[model samples]
Target: MKVMIRKDSKGTLSAYVPKKDLEEPIVSIARPQMWGGLVTLANGWRLELPEMAADTALPITVEARRVAGGED
Candidate 1:
């Protein structure tokens, strides 16, 4: 298994090793986006995903980690 040692802002030792990454990298996907069926407002445009419409929103946070390999 691979281990990725890192330190947090609180100054603590930590190791991060994703379950998928442990078995080496696998197939990656990159989809293309088309500008069709897009709505344009006074300032910006938006796309609606009626299929994925939800009554509430979820909180999201971004976390950065330094890996030993190349940039991801």
Candidate 2:
């Protein structure tokens, strides 16, 4: 529902968090509980998405917009 964010020295995505309050890290609103998905790496150190998420996002985006009255 919300995001708490910070960037590392090299501009990589260090964390993507959502929480009730900031102080931070200890609080989580979009905690791993609801946002669970497969996480992998493109080069072992870099991050990649699992096949399911990779395959699902685009169609799901369309479906969500349709439900939201934003798409046909």
Residue 49 displacement in candidate 2 (angstroms): 18
| Candidate 1 ranges with C-alpha deviation above 4 Å | 20-72
lDDT of 2 by residue, 1-72 (tens): 223233345533322322323222212222232123322212222112222332232212110000122111
Best by the lDDT measure: 1
Clashing pairs in 2: 18-29, 19-29
TM-score of each: 0.25, 0.21
Scored by lDDT, model 2 comes in at 0.24
- Local distance difference test scores for all models: 0.26, 0.24
In model 2, which runs have C-alpha deviations exceeding 4 angstroms? 18-72
For residue 21, give model 2's deviation from the true position in Å: 11
Predicted structure with the largest TM-score when compared to the true one:
1
